[model samples]
Target: MDAAPSTSSRVQFRRRNVASRARWVEEAGAGEVVESKGKLWLTTGVTRGSKLCYNVEEIGFLVEKGALILLNDKDEMIGIEAIYEKIAVGKYGCSWDAFQAYKHLKSLGYIVG
Candidate 1:
């Protein structure tokens, strides 16, 4: 977290799919895998929290927008700025806007991914 103003246009955020309030609280292991809607989701171990197991582009979208804050192996919240750099190089994933949309829909009781 460098001291950049919150409104900076350089924030670099974009989402490629539907999002959810579900924080990817931790990187999942093969042990946490679960299946729903014919898609695999992992029990993130956040008191029943679940995150769809997936890829980099989408993850970058989330991190850049401040929607999904991924925790490192050490359990530290990753900053959007660092993610933005990686995204530029074509790595990482998740949708920040999708998370926002997921939260919005969840308030209405819709199960979103």
Candidate 2:
């Protein structure tokens, strides 16, 4: 793991949709992948094959912490508000309240499953 950056690093993550309710992200696009010096994936997300995939809640938490900046297929920056909107649309157990709890738990130094 690298040292934490002095400022927030703008990472590019492409949306990898497995289903209507499942929203995951991968460090995609051409060129070099932006390094998030902080512990971005150490506690969140899971590895699918060679890629690190983040769910809706995980992505929201990362974006809220300024550890990620998601990008579209066209390489456009997806705003934080847009990210929250996407997270809100998530079904099943993923929701803004759930994300809030996740963020709060992480802030308290507890590792979330």
Candidate 3:
């Protein structure tokens, strides 16, 4: 009988879409005006035979002068101005704010293509 392969020869599988937390800010009678302080799993832009891959990252938030701020691991401010400007004009209808935020982040080089 042949022995099984060593531990190093075994392939490891990881599951995507793990759970995380998100903070929602609501206005008086408005319902979920903003969301912040969450850990999101973002794609690394690598495709495996047609499927996309993602990894998790921690995010922080700050509301300053009516702007929704997103901070990095070093607590540095990542610009969300373009996103806000786009939203103000009602251009991002049908899509939720989360999606818009993702797009904005991607555009800013935070996420790879």
Best by lDDT: 2
Candidate 1 has which clashing residue pairs, if any? 19-98, 56-92, 56-93, 58-93, 58-94, 59-93, 59-94, 60-93, 62-94, 62-96
User: What are the per-residue Cα lDDT tens digits for candidate 2 across 1-113?
Assistant: 99886974344343433111222343421112234344555776666666566666666666655566666656676677877776676552477888889877877778898
TM-score of 2: 0.63
TM-score of each: 0.34, 0.63, 0.19
For each candidate, what is the lDDT? Answer: 0.40, 0.58, 0.32
Model 3 root-mean-square deviation:
16.9
Q: Which rank order by TM-score, best down to worst? A: 2, 1, 3
Candidate 1 lDDT trough over 10 residues, lowest sum: 29-38
> How do the residues 62-85 of candidate 1 rate in per-residue lDDT, one tens digit apiece?
345444445554545556565445
TM-score of 3: 0.19
Q: Clashes in each model (backbone N, CA, C under 3 Å)?
A: 10, 0, 0
- What is the C-alpha lDDT profile of model 3 across 1-113, one tens digit per residue? 99998765222222212222222211211112123223322433233344332211112111211223333335444444533443445433323455446445654557533
Candidate 1, residue 5: how far the Cα is off, in Å: 20
- List pairs with backbone clashes in candidate 3: none
Better of 1 and 3 by lDDT: 1
Residue ranges of candidate 2 with Cα displaced over 4 Å: 1-36
